[model samples]
Target: MVAGGFSELGEEGRMLEAQVKARINGTGTRVIGPNTVGVLFPHSALNTALTPNDRIYYPGKGSVAFISQSGALGLLVMDSITEFGMGVSGFVNIGNRADVTEVEVLSMFMDDPNTRSIVLYLESISDGATFFSKAMEASLTKPVVMLKTGRSEESSRAASFHTGAMATDDRVLDGVLRQAGVICAYDEVELLDYGKVLAYQSPPSGDRIAVITTAGGVGVVTTDLLTTAHDGVRLRMAAFSPEEKAELRKYALPIASVNNPIDLTADGSSEAYA
Candidate 1:
């Protein structure tokens, strides 16, 4: 992997990058990045990360494989994973995508037996159709979580300057992700959280949920969250029909509100909930 920086946006750097690629064109050598920190495999103890090893913390071997378009953010994510007491099977920084691409690496991780979930932070896609195709197939076997940046025009320009990546229309991206059956995380934390949760837990069969709480205010807040749309996806509160409520009332406490957000009250026994 070429862990060195190349200013693809500049003329001289582009020329140099071309020369580097030509040197190894037919040698069967694959390059990861010109602006990337490179790849890391915690299980195999192989690290070609460009970041200083002394200052950065690395995650242990685990089921998640993280792919990032940003080199520095990739390091920060590794540090954050260690802090969160989580580990990754592998971490790859697909910088500039001169040769290797996000979808290609994603396909590689899909074949890896150790990877249960795939998480990616992307600013742009080099090949959108292939990415969606590969992601759709991978999602059928394991979870695929993405945290995509460059939503706004300003950020789109910023990303182009940063990685020389072309941005896609956000509206189109949303529809594509849904068709691909890939989960979208709003931020960095959500990306990791969704990855961890998906790795450890089975996905719910449906969006219907029942919130049970001793505190009415907490239940109300949770209900709002369940009903509210986030990143184009919304949860549905499981409405308790009159018949279901009547049945629950038979066993619940006298003052319990047998509604969707079931308020058992503080006095309600644990047995009543059961």
Candidate 2:
């Protein structure tokens, strides 16, 4: 169902895309895309992605469902997911969305029992009101993460050329997504990182964090990073209780520090980690 050379090609292509959309408007069958790579559902063994199976590794069964606007970018993310050992439940590349939109797909994922988290890579949104409502509703039960491009004028122009899309204002988009409780990712790395954490772990009860590292310098940097305010949330390093420090000292080497950073020195081992 996914074919390129549609609206992105200009006026003629736009007309062609409109005709295709009209033909499928009333049909019960939902179309994923007219110019897209297609969908992949690992649990069902369904793979309609245009990217060859051998080109990139598909992750194992996971609770994260990823939806992307760019097929190539989706493939790149899939490759990264494999490298990071992150699993995915489904992937959909809805390029030049002729019939199906992100809102519709998001609603389906929201009701999917297998999906615990949703990640999206979008150059543009088709219907702002529908997207906001759907995303807001879905975020109430599951984490909805998004990496929206086109923040810069140059990038916006490029997105327009690539997908025939008009980019929304970056500030407005940020405010709207934030109000909807959608976690916004700045890049691909953040997108997957957020997805993995949400899929595998429960939400933290508090913003307090404890860093355990073999490298002292890494611990310091991590403490600084955690303590910094992100959005409106700030994380502080948790202070260790005397009993906790005593327990740590039993496992740590004589020279190891039992403070909040809990630096176990370079000789730290699996037993120490445990």
Candidate 3:
């Protein structure tokens, strides 16, 4: 693996990158990058990230495997998720993607027993068909969440320089990913939230969900996110029986809304929830 190089430099650097690729050809050796932060395996205490351990936070050992095209984003996510107490099985930063590709890593992690789910942050996909195929296969066995950038012209151009990645129309890509049983997150917060849920919790067996909140507005927003299709998948509000509603009303304040989304108002207390 070439830890770092000049691929981010522009024209001359790209030429040098080509030379490196040629040097590795027919050697039965696959190279990670001419420019990369490399990989991290927390379980084995192996960290190839460019930053020092004291300078950056790494995730603990668990089941989620993360793959990111941007090294900085990977580092930030590593800090945020680990800080939030989410454990990770491995992390890969595929900067420039000279030889080792996301598809290859997806295949590897999907088969790893320690990996209960996979999360990816990508600016572009090198091979859409193969990626979708492998992603679908992985989703069937476990969970897969993707956060892809380059949805707009400006962002697409930025991605070109960041990783030499060619952008695809996100509208079409979103539909394809949904068909592959992959969940798409628009930002880092959603990426981490979705990954944490998938890693620690089993998927819901029913189409039912109930939002309980002390704040009415939060309950409304939660209901909206749940009912109006979260990332192309619709959620249903579970129906409550008359007896159940009466039981809930007995505990909540008179002003509390005891509907599908049980809003306890701002005056809600622990006993109300109990």
Candidate 4:
């Protein structure tokens, strides 16, 4: 890792070379910090970091390539996905983004046969127009879920501790992402949850959902959540046929009420989901 950051490397180019070299070298085999966090190509079974860590658990080889600007988050995501029982084909932590970027990663993943989805947690955009254009191109082939941090002045203040600079340009980033069809997550948990959902499910064939609940109050709250205006989400309740409504009565409580947010009342069970 030390060898990767040497001054023989001018500042950017040479340093990147050193990092790549350390990755290529075996005796220097276990090093991962010459310039950036090394990548994981799961199909190859390649683990060459200096510490020889195997923290990422990707199973069955799926098509999502996770790219993050923060190395630590990259590692954490690997662990999270493993816990969630999902598989990943590639992982990249493009620190400094001096050599690789979200645009480049998206471009590469779009072409990779194994990648059907892409997840990103970005801090800032070095080139907004170029990134958005590339992202749009990639999205035509696969879904991209992005969680952009450092949105407010306060968050930017926190960002300075890591990269020593404020990184928020909230409106511009939001506009660019939405125009390109990139789904944004608001926080880490949301990032994982929504990304997982998109990874497994196809985009809505239509924008209608049928909510069946036993609790009326819970159903009301859920309807409010879905109907409340938001930037990227607009959900509509699906209508059921009379026959479907009649079938619902078999499982509804004696006085159950059925509507857009259908209250299955007291008869719903785990088997319903199964």
lDDT of 4 at 217: 90
Please give the lDDT score at residue 185 for candidate 4.
Answer: 78
**How would you encode candidate 3's per-residue C-alpha lDDT over 50-129 as one tens digit per residue?**
88888987888989999998888898999998899888999998888878999999999999989998999999998999
Candidate 2 lDDT over residue span 1-274, tens digit each? 6778877777898899888878877787677777788888988988887877667788878899999988889989988998998878899998888888889889989999999999999999999999999999999899999999999999999988887778799999989998998988888988999999999776576778888999899998888767766542357788889999998899999998999898999999998998
Candidate 3's displacement at residue 3, Å, is: 5.8
> What residue runs in model 3 are displaced by over 4 Å at the alpha carbon?
1-14, 229-233, 243-255, 265-274
Candidate 4: residue 205 lDDT (0-100): 66
Off by over 4 Å in 1: 1-8, 230-232, 246-253, 266-274
- Candidate 1 lDDT, 76-98, residue by residue in tens: 98989999999998999998887
Backbone clashes in candidate 1 total 0
Error of 4 at 192 (Å): 1.6
**TM-score ranking of the models:** 1, 3, 2, 4
Summing lDDT over every window of 10 consecutive residues in candidate 1, give the lowest-scoring window.
1-10
Candidate 4 global TM-score = 0.77
Error of 4 at 58 (Å): 6.2
lDDT of each: 0.87, 0.88, 0.87, 0.68
lDDT for 29 (candidate 2): 66
**How many residue pairs clash (N, CA or C atoms closer than 3 angstroms) in each of the candidate models, in the order given?**
0, 0, 0, 4
Worst 10 residues of 4 by lDDT: 1-10
Estimate, for each residue in 1-274, the C-alpha lDDT of model 4 and write its tens digit: 3233332234564466556665566653333333345677776675432223454444436567888766677777777877878777677766555435567777888888877788897777757789889888887768888988888888776654443333757988887897898877787767777767777776676778877777889988887766665633668878888988887767666677766687665666665423
